[model samples]
Target: MCNDSKIHGFLEKLPKCEHHVHLEGCLTPELMFTLAARNGIKLPDPETRPEFSSAESLYTRYENFTSLDDFLSYYFIGMSVLKQQDDYEALAWEYFQKANADGVHHAEVFFDPQEHINRGVLYDTVVSGFTAGCRRAEKEYGMTTKLILCFVKHLPASDASKVFDLAVERGDFDSGVVHGIGASSSEVGPPKDMFKEIYATAHSKGIQRTAHAGEEGDPSYISAALDAYKSQRIDHGIRLIDSPSLMERIVKDEILLTVCPVSNVKLRCFDHISQVPIRRFLDAGVKFSINSDDPAYFGGFILHNYCAVQEAFGLSIADWRLIALNSIEGSWIEQERKLELLKLVDEHIDKHLAD
Candidate 1:
């Protein structure tokens, strides 16, 4: 295990790629209040909504979540503050700034379209604003980004299909900002099979597929996501450790599991970060990468997540390097770009070690 200072320095310099962050979930309370005032939206009463009393207060409330459902209730409440195109743009830009500062060169972020669209926010507005932010981040910070539109499981599959069609219709899918489609929200009863047709539609259109499974659900959910939905990646797939056969299939198939340790602990998936099954994945030779699923709510960004996991598990520099490599390899970017990023990682590590 590296010392705390070494780990901090190494993580700060590491070229990271986050694959599981939610764009909406990145809304910090400061930004939430800023946007709420700018949009003329009234926040809930502080007496009743003590979480909104202050940024720190809200964070404390987020920490008290008992389950995924409990956290998501507040997650949607925070998202309600977003109204216009500028709000979405600011949200994406804010997250990109944080990611860039954390040495994240590339990111594949998730956005819930149905959540906004159902609230009368136009699909085009969200895409246009978010893509504009992506452009700015590239120009300003050299941080490349791709937006993955996620379908909320609580909504009907038909609603998801409509959003997919709307994306295609508005040329968002073809605009290069939107690269993939996936599912999010409560993974309890809405099985992957429910969105099989939607996945098929996205596949036909050459869009990559992924889903949130096996975090709050069973290992069978992971299998269904892989076999039935044909997902190219699995988000929050920690529960796969429960089934050796399923774990073997994941290893043999080379499926990428985007494990978010901080979010898992915050949502009560595990009582503590030390209990997270990252070491299990490493021992089993299962391919996985660490990410901050919802940095704002989970009390850390990607870098904090890395540091926390390193300290908890006493991960060596080599282990951290492997996780970085897995993130780049498992990303939805082109092969040429992936190669270039991997080369950068090697160069960074060599320079750090020499020093």
Candidate 2:
């Protein structure tokens, strides 16, 4: 964003909290091949899907994504290789290392259990591996993590309900193995209230909730998530700008919007990073956190997302401080942990801008 090394250093050191990154989305092409070969899984022939030939070729294909569904096609292909608990653990550890290097102190990650269940991978395998990775992150990097089991919305609600029942049977929410639930994938076609009953159950039990809204869909998608799903946070609510009243309501309620800059441009939601409306949201008093929704596919990680926003908007120190605070506030962590993050931000502000 700035030529000044001091400002750049400050951005690098800022503690980040990502709420929208999907664990499966972090499956890099290199890892996919390793796991595929280890598990004896067959990838599509090179003639039909040339991207399967090599990691380099697959990454080249990632650069030309035309839409969310287009990227998802490749995303699911990458997940085919993750056949064992170790594979899932490796995938999360890989992402956690990168996140730690980028200064992430806390994270609420998303994973689709239904997708894995359909693949014949047991739910316990997925949770244990990811949970193991999270524990390692906490021990080694001192970073806390919360897992959010996301439902593949394009799948039948009956499928999701079944998964929900399994989660309840396992006491996933009550025991905190999974912190919450969210709806994702194919946002446009799914009925807005498809997960209403599930949300009602979660709300009745006082569990946390969130959803992907207003990213590929319209502002009404965001409203439905609130009115119907009663989500505490809105993931990718960039389209909230289209509805003034919705924007007002969001500000009044202090609902956090997890906005992904590079993902939006890659998915063609916006033509360029500059079109992401960073300054608009800041000026309008809308609380939002910059994230890399699917960094492996979208071409950047959390720091890369932060750099893109800064390069586009040249936001001042106060602006960045606010953004960092907004992210911390939106994090579904304990109040004591939230206070610690706030203290870190204050230290960074003093160290970086003390000149």
Candidate 3:
């Protein structure tokens, strides 16, 4: 087999799993307009306004965001059109179809409830609508999905706690639709300790926990998330590279870091693709997974993320294989399912080599 061709084919056919994707973040402009029209919401004119015309324009507008707050502003703006269950259902279904087309078999989807709730979109409205899509996606596409309810970090921890309690009380997560609790939003405000009590409550309820740390924050935040909340995963712990000791601890504990390369580029997390530390983490035996944090705005999905980094750094076939395996290792699926997916990935690589 031609080495590059074989590797490219394997990537296309790999049975992948994503651990760090946002629900509303996956809303494409095409679907955005469709949902807005159906919901009778008015979007800025795409005709007179050149910025809302296509995916390219949306990506250009998004790339200008310099901070987490800037990204959140647009993120919430695109989500404003989603006012009902059908809107949420359409978003979830659309994401699942895209994932399916990209060969993703399992995913742990993150949703920022605080964003929707503050906008008068009930917690159940967001949860149930996506839950409906998960059910249908499973039946129709053979995809397994789990939801991670994320707390907007800019909000007070007490408000985050309220959101968690509501999810539990309303039974929005009882059926495994909502499997874990996560922390997202601007990383600059509300130090990690702010969410200590909220994480404790989530821990007490037997819910899995994870947090976004070390993306734009200091390596100390990564330590805080693990030490304070005992998070099972760390989202975009990129700054962990700044501290050798913390990097060792993360690898020692086998905690997963859900790294979003495209989002990082758009948010200016790294100056260039070469600065991404995925290879460094891998070489050091740190567990990490690639994901598209906000694909709608970030110009690429999960596969595009892998392809971009792979080409940027001249990753070898073995490296790509390890990256694919890393995704399975970081997934929230059951052990049996994880094993099955690994086998499928291996089979895909083998088939590609044969071809």
Candidate 4:
């Protein structure tokens, strides 16, 4: 590991923006137990559900998932413990505090409404609590946040449309709390083309669009998301490197890729962190940023992701600066805020050099 104090200091001080984290995925086992007890829900028995046996055992099992499907089985189980608005608010608030301490000044968080609604949780309860949590984070930690409602692609398009309509009916699209729409989960059958109508509705309402594509899907999925869904940014677009033409298009269009190194490794997208192709993306002029897709499950947060990549790739201070700047630029925030964060990045880098 590169343990140079200067490099560590630079990473600690650099301002960051995390664009692709699932709020539910941020639930740690410690919090899981706390929330489960508060809600009077009993976690599955250890004999039957060894994954929930103990916090340490759960983490060990989390590290052993053979595929994305395996990880999600546990992911949904973690969601079941959350039943009320207070639960949701506490979840978001905890993430904000941890993210703030990690040097994240801005975060665009993803949440799956259908996951909660299918479990009998109301959409109003979810949004109201999450929005309140964002306000609290801003007030307490000066952390700017925006929520993105991610439609699970494995679900029917009609179901996703209902979620979109709910957001629209509640004026979430205009509320400034919910800033965008995204597609996530099981990118196998329901292609990005499936969400065309939903994206169109969001665009019509002036909400930003983004989607998870090319993590395990083909490069063509990335193309479909860009062309059909008109995605402003792509989450986990690491496979774009497979198609040089598509990569060129991404660079030309400047579609930002929120690449998660630890998630990629944990999900078996890459055999090791060194094989993640971050350097290749940099060389190709692709606009990309580091993120922690499902930090709790993937065993790393945004800062840990950055540090792992830095050590694996032996990234210089200049490289770290570009990555930090790309995160702010890729964020769905106002240009004024983007510029302000960029200035913070520059000042941090300059301070490190002077030291």
Best by lDDT: 2
lDDT of 1 by residue, 245-328 (tens): 999999999999999999999898899899999788888888888888888888878888888888889877688788888889
After superposition, the stretches of candidate 1 with alpha carbons farther than 4 Å from their true spots are 1-3
What's the best-to-worst order under TM-score? 2, 4, 1, 3
Clashing pairs in 4: none
Whole-model lDDT per candidate:
0.88, 0.91, 0.84, 0.88
Best by TM-score: 2
Q: Where is model 4 more than 4 Å wrong at Cα?
A: none
lDDT of 4 by residue, 15-128 (tens): 999999999999999889988989988888989887778899999988887777778888888988999899999989888887887899998999999989887899989998
What are the per-model numbers of colliding residue pairs?
Answer: 0, 0, 0, 0
Model 3, 1-355: lDDT tens digits are 1236655666767788888999999998777877778878777788877777776787677768887788887787789888999889989988898888877899899988887788788888888899999999899988889999888877777778788777788776566768998988888767777888878877777789999999889998999999899899999999998999998999889998998887888889887777899779879998888888988878878778777787777777677788788889888789998899889988887777677
- By lDDT rank, best first, the candidates go 2, 1, 4, 3
What's model 2's TM-score? 0.98
lDDT, candidate 4, residue 353?
84
TM-score of 4: 0.97
Candidate with better TM-score, 2 vs 3: 2
Q: Tell me the deviation in Å of residue 47 in model 2.
A: 1.2
